[model samples]
Target: MTSPGVAPGLLRVQGLCSGYGRSQVLFGVDLHIGEGEILGVLGRNGMGKTTLVRSIMGLLRPTGGTVELGGRAIVGLAPHRVARQGIAVVPEGRQVFANLSVLEHLTAFARGGHGTAHAWTIDRLLHLFPRLAERRSNLGGQLSGGEQQMLAIARALATNPRLLILDEATEGLAPLVREEVWHALSTLRQAGMSMLVIDKYVRRLIGLADRHVILEKGEVAWTGSSAQLEADRSLWSRHLGL
Candidate 1:
């Protein structure tokens, strides 16, 4: 299942179906994230965008289909096993360890066992998130909302994953912080980090992501390049009601 492109994809998902309790959220969702490309998952709230991420991360078990990371079957595996396999996710709501200090959070989740490169070391993470460095000794709860979001991304990156999935990467942040986050994402893309970005910024997603997949009513209603999505504004207005 090789995706043809400049720098082919590292993550591939097909026929993904998942749910909470008995209520299914994702129904036959399909998507891919190229080796160095940024893929955006677009949809209105409660449209199953976050559920797709949870399924891929193994935080939620898929009722059907496969989630392959670097071309290996990972469906139904434990969350830690999935993370160990080089698939890391910054879940929605920036779930940082409230009891840990900023630096502690980094150290606790440091890269190990995988023998991956140190591209996301504490120093580099600090550089990427200067505010976190400023509050390195502060408890995670002591940081602002935007700062906590930064820490969440930094914590995920510190694992040095092959495919990074960010659920609502820039949600609820101030405009300036959102800009900073977009800047960091752009830099990561340039550095050849494959990412699955979920956000509501249509205009910016068009610029940053190489491809786009829109989830509607728990299904993949649209899939194409960013240009295709931008060209068809009606698609968004019709499916996402944006």
Candidate 2:
């Protein structure tokens, strides 16, 4: 599903390579996410999953390769510039500001969501995440782990991005809270929100992602659809350590 007058996919990272200082992490990584499609990035810890996300989000500049959003080159842009291209992220570790209230966090970077008929406004976000609404007056440090994850997501949604990236989406959340987060993600997918999800729950990802990209030591180790992944359990056994 291409955006009007744009290409079919929301994101494309071709031969991506980057790292801190000279310690190269990502090595020629390649992947894509179509509009309204969900792509799961899976790998063991330190395999460059977050590095890829950081590269795409302009948190790190790639030493080689290209990053395209809606078919336009976005490599070497500033984080704000990349964000202006209608991208948002729920970074790993939540990164919630202890001083900010739930409402403050949500409104920090309010940009009416793109490519959606129903943009993610504060009211809409509150409705979507009732717990956040309940804790609207609470400080970020006051909320539980589940509440923080929801807040992080809500903060991103408030920007109304065309592509939403969630690093370690369900990490550290309670089982029930993870289910809640996943359920919300499923709803967003159905609502046509293109997403790149990184999570440890392989089984849940198999059901949620339209496609999967397995990163092994910062490289594209495997790429396939849910059906292909499910048909080959060896993928998990070998690459994911499942």
Candidate 3:
């Protein structure tokens, strides 16, 4: 079920199906992201974008299909176990703790005792998002939407994951703030970080992701390279409701 021309690389999700109770959302969704590659998930609202991510992260168990990371089956693993397999998620809502300071948020969730040379440290994360550095002593509730989003991303990176999943990378932020988030993503890509990014900004996704997958009615409707996607506006109008 791999998309044509997409190598099943770092992360591979095949025929993945999941739902809440009896109401199914994702319908055999298939996608893959290679090492150092960014894959964009696109669709109109309620097209199973979040469900797909939840399934991949083991937040929700799938009724069928398989999810593999680096060739290891991770379908039924607990959420934390899946995360320990080198995957981290920046969830859709930018869920930062209200009482936790920026510094605490970074340090609390950081994966410890595995100090590689390139492991993400607080210093490195601060360098990535200087705004977080300036607000180190401030509670997560005190930061603006943009700053919260940055903190969420930084917190995920603190895990030093091999693969990162971001649901709604830039939702509900000022245009300028969105750009800043995009810039940080670009920086991560340049550093050879693998990412699965779900964002509403189709144009921005096209510019950032190496390939794109469009979901419709809980299924993957189309998937192709950025050049292929850019050339087909009809795909947008049909699947994404652009």
lDDT of 2 by residue, 1-242 (tens): 22233246578888999999989999999888887788899999999999998899888989999999999999989999999998898999998898899999978867765656888889988988899999999999999999999999999888899899999979988999999999999888777788899998999998988889999999999998888898999999899898
Each candidate: what lDDT?
0.86, 0.89, 0.90
TM-score for each of the candidates: 0.93, 0.95, 0.94
Model 1 superposed RMSD (Cα): 1.9
Question: In terms of lDDT, which candidate is strongest?
Answer: 3
lDDT of 3 by residue, 1-242 (tens): 34455455789999999999999998898888887788999999899999998898899999999999999999999999999999999998898999999999998988852334577889989999989999999999999999999999999999999898999868999999999999999999888788999998999999989999999999998988899999999998888778
Candidate 1 per-residue lDDT, tens place, 1-242, comes to 32356565477888999999999998888877767778888989999988888888888999998988878899978999999999889888999989999999999887852444447788988998888889999998998999999999999988888888888889899999999899989888877788889989899988898888888899988888888898998987897777
**Which is better, 1 or 3, measured by TM-score?**
3
For candidate 3, the 10 contiguous residues with the lowest summed lDDT are 1-10
Cα error of candidate 2 at position 193, Å: 0.5
Worst ten in a row by lDDT for model 2: 1-10
